[model samples]
Target: MENKNIIITGTSRGIGFELALQFADAGHQVLAISRKMPKSLMEHSNITCLSIDISDENEMEQVEKFVKDSWSNKVDVLINNAGLLVNKPFEQLTTSDFEQVYKVNVFAVAALTQVCIPFMKKGSHVVTISSMGGIQGSMKFPGLAAYSSSKGAVITLFELLAEEYKESGIAFNVLALGAVNTEMLQEAFPGYEAPLSAKEMANYIFDFSLNGNKYYNGKVLQVSSTTP
Candidate 1:
């Protein structure tokens, strides 16, 4: 790596936090954005932790300011890892619940990417994390209605973006992740052990974030060992 500038959202904990650590350790200019401050993330000299809820459109402006002042308004890699999962049955799920989920998982992705597009030049990659539940090889688990739908939209959004920005040199892709043993997974499927840990998932995500788009464009990769 050539000391690239990297931006990773949802860095409060789990895979997002791990990604922030790896990038910072590699001597990259890493910006870790989340709603709350992660103490470990704040300690790294190469990592800048910004506490901003992506669902709030106004807060994304802070990213614009930070990029302008610190990175000269240019970024090499952008990891859109922030997500909100609404674990509720279809009958129990209210319209508000779905809206809230979309606000974070879907709309916020577009909002943040829009704000960051001005900073991205050629060879820049946009990697957004999706879920297997939204695509094939997924079991359509209970309480994942809103979550799966949002992820499905994510898959489509980046696919479209890949074409829209093809001439601009911005590569876009989605990683439809499986059950990583993160807090979110545990909350959804209590007492169930996932096949992979957050660190394990982070390793794969880090690799894809770096070079997966070199050959593939408008792609959605279902990252998991388990099959239906």
Candidate 2:
């Protein structure tokens, strides 16, 4: 990953935070984006923090322009790790909740990718963070209809994008994370126990990014700490 420049969304906390740190530790220049800035992240020469809401088109475009201008048309990776979740029975979920989740979880990923695509050089990997629920619905869970549906849409978009760019040297894949201890999950399941920590999930994602290959392109991987 030498000379790689990574733009990671949702970096204020959780797996996004850890991923940004890992990328910086690996000596790759990282552009960390989040709606709110983290007060405690240690300043690093390789890391540049940008405040931008993934759902905000104008702000995201500003990020794109900054990357293009600063890096000279080189965006090594675009990680769509921002997401939203609202748990409630399908009937209890409001139309506003559905629209909100879709805007950030699905639309932002697509829009941000499109903004970065023109400047992405060869061998760039586009990784989107989805969830296990996207692959197989969890019948036992409540209020995940909108979230799961949005993640499923992201997976489908990644697959289509991979097919479209297969001959163009860019790779696309979705990491369908399972039960990571992030604030989003905490909001959905107030008393739920998390099976994995955000740092652990972030490590797995960084490792997966390092192993990019055409064979794994278009695939959705279920990442769990206890899984083989």
Candidate 3:
């Protein structure tokens, strides 16, 4: 494939980090966004690291500017992979906790996608990382009221966006992942070993983001091997 301009959020570690490295290694230009820039990503010539809180609206403008000035107003793929998880019992969870999680998981995804839409042309793909917990009929867990709900919200958001933008020929899809042994997972379920590693899941997402649009649109794929 020819070199494409790709943007991914939450690249400081885990699947986001692996996705950035994998795409860059494949000769694609990558704009990796995270709260902190990873040293390894900085060393890669194909990757450009941006340290900015996605929840901050003012800071998000920087992404648009970069796309216009640096990427020359072109974005082939956008991965909304940055997510915030708050693990607290329903009784103990505060309103602030819900806001915090939604700010990053739902609002940021919407904001970032809006900013990049102008630059994304026909055949471009927007992939949002969701959780199986977000699915309506999927199993639910304790202490995930806020986190799981926010993931579900984004799933619906992307589905609506896909239909709204169908005429534009840009595809929007959601991947509801089960477990992938990332830092977030450890926090949610301590000592639980996931069957898939970060790199393994990233590899799947990498390919899906590139070609899944051709076969599916406004759809949610359940990427999981285990229950809960």
**Tens digits of per-residue lDDT for model 1, 1-228:** 588899999999899999999888978889999988778789889999999989999999999999999999898889999888878888999999999999999999999899889899988999999988889546898888999999998899999999999999889999898888888887788888888888888988888888887877889988888732
TM-score of 3: 0.99
Which lDDT tens digits does candidate 3 get at residues 46-117? 999999999998999999989988989999999999999998889999989999999999999999999999
Backbone clashes in candidate 2 total 1
Query: What is the number of backbone collisions in each predicted candidate, taken in the order shown?
Result: 0, 1, 0
CA-only RMSD, every prediction:
1.2, 2.2, 0.6
Q: Rank the candidates by TM-score, best first.
A: 3, 1, 2
Q: Which of 1 and 3 is the better model by TM-score? A: 3
Which regions in candidate 3 have their CA more than 4 angstroms from the true location?
Answer: none
Candidate 2 residues lying further than 4 Å off, grouped into runs, are 137-140, 225-228
Best-to-worst ranking by lDDT: 3, 1, 2
Lowest summed-lDDT stretch of 10 residues in model 2? 134-143
Q: How accurate is candidate 3 locally (lDDT)?
A: 0.95
- Decide which is better by lDDT, 1 or 2: 1
Residue-level lDDT for 2 in candidate 1: 85
